[model samples]
Target: MCVSHSVSPDFCDKVMFLLAQEHRGPLRGGGGAGRTAQEGGGAGRTAQEGGGDGCIALEAGGDGCIALEAGGDGCIALEAGGDGCIALEADGDGCIALEACGDCCIALEAGGDGCIALEAGGDGCIALEAGGDGCIALEADGDGCIALQAGGDGCIALEAGGDGCIALEAGGDGCIALETGGE
Candidate 1:
């Protein structure tokens, strides 16, 4: 198994393990719960905890699901196992998630200033949320129930593309909100 960034092999193993923990559950794009992934030994907290790197802390809280913990700047938590589900997270300032990938399901969250969540991805239900100043959620994607939510000033929620339930909500002033297709 090839690990990205500086995540320890042991930590990566644990994250892979949790990805399939029946209790951990799957990360269904933007409208689900579960926090998985870490950087530089930061630790992956379930969506329930609602804090930490690669965490799935949605506005609607629930039983924290899964998270891959790590300790490093710009670390990428990539686990390619688990009933066709993959969850990745990045920590520190200005971390970037998947920018261009098609097909398959991906749940990516960035917790830092000027971080980029999901960008130019295709297919499946994609949910990308960014937390911190100047964060960008989803930008130019295609066909899926895309929901993009960003928190902090100068944040951009969604920017074009996708043909499904597109819900975009941004926090703080100067934030943009655009919703089209479905409710």
Candidate 2:
């Protein structure tokens, strides 16, 4: 792997391990109440669960699959699942998420006050979203589709669907939108 800036030896080792286990097998985990689980698998198969305040979970599963989740106040999650798919989610105050699912799909979501999300689903699709005060979003669905959106005061959105379709929209003060569909 390459990076723009220098990294510590420990960071490099961790990154190497993560890359090396991309084609190993399957990994799964479950956390107890008010606990968090973090796991990494080989051959791209991983799953994890988290509960309680400020919890985080991360997993890489299946053929380049990954999954991650976080719960309670100030939570963050990241996951990559299925064939080259990834998913991330966070809930409660100050939440952020990033996810990719299905065949080369990515999805991200955050809920509650100050939330930000990015997601990609279906075959070759990309999506991003943000909610609550000062929100922004982007989403893409279907085969080769893309979308972006933002909700609440000062928002922007973009969406695309079907074969090579694109759409953009903004809500509240200062808004804009661009949309396209079909082949």
Q: On residues 14-95, what C-alpha lDDT tens digit does candidate 2 reach at each position?
A: 4346434522433223545544355545644555666555445655566555566666675556665565554666667666
What would you estimate as the lDDT of candidate 1? 0.47
lDDT of each: 0.47, 0.59
| RMSD of each predicted structure | 13.3, 7.9
Model 1: lDDT of residue 169: 63
lDDT of 2: 0.59
lDDT for position 143 in model 1: 57
lDDT, candidate 1, 10-98, per-residue tens? 74475456544523543323333453332222233222223333443222111222233333464444432223345455567755343
Q: Candidate 1: lDDT of 110?
A: 68
Candidate 2: segments with Cα more than 4 A from true spot: 1-50, 58-64, 181-183
Q: List residue ranges in candidate 1 displaced over 4 A.
A: 1-69, 80-85, 96-103, 118-123, 138-143, 158-163, 180-183
